[model samples]
Target: MAKETKNFVLRLDAQTMEAIEKWAEDEFRSVNGQILYILCEALKKSKRLPKTKNEPTKSNT
Candidate 1:
């Protein structure tokens, strides 16, 4: 599959940047990937994530 991605500038203080670096290293993900994964997971868990562009979502009765 082709990669789905968008580039956006985000502002973070030094400490937050440091933390993200450490966490990304610990989780074996690049910093950008870690942030994207985290946001995706959060949206999924919150039921705010949509089905894939090609997939239909079933509504609960």
Candidate 2:
């Protein structure tokens, strides 16, 4: 399956950039990958992402 992605420019302060770089390195992912991971997690936490077939469903007992 092909996933579509959009490219955009982001500006960060020097300290913020340094922090993100360190975090990315620790996670063994590129800065962009780390950013994307964080964004997806936030979306999931906020229930903003639509349900997908591959995602497991939770049952209420």
Q: Write the per-residue lDDT of candidate 2 for residues 1-51, one digit (tens) a residue.
A: 899989999999999889989999999999999989989999999999898
**What lDDT does each candidate get?**
0.87, 0.91
lDDT of 1 by residue, 1-61 (tens): 9979778899999999899899999999999988888899999899898777666656632
State residue 37's C-alpha deviation in candidate 1, in Å: 1.1
lDDT value, residue 14 of candidate 1: 95
TM-score (all chains, Cα) for each model: 0.75, 0.83
- Best-fitting candidate, scored by TM-score: 2
- List clashing residue pairs in candidate 1: none
Best by lDDT: 2
- The per-residue C-alpha lDDT of model 2 at residue 26 equals 100
Where is the poorest 10-residue window by lDDT in model 2?
52-61
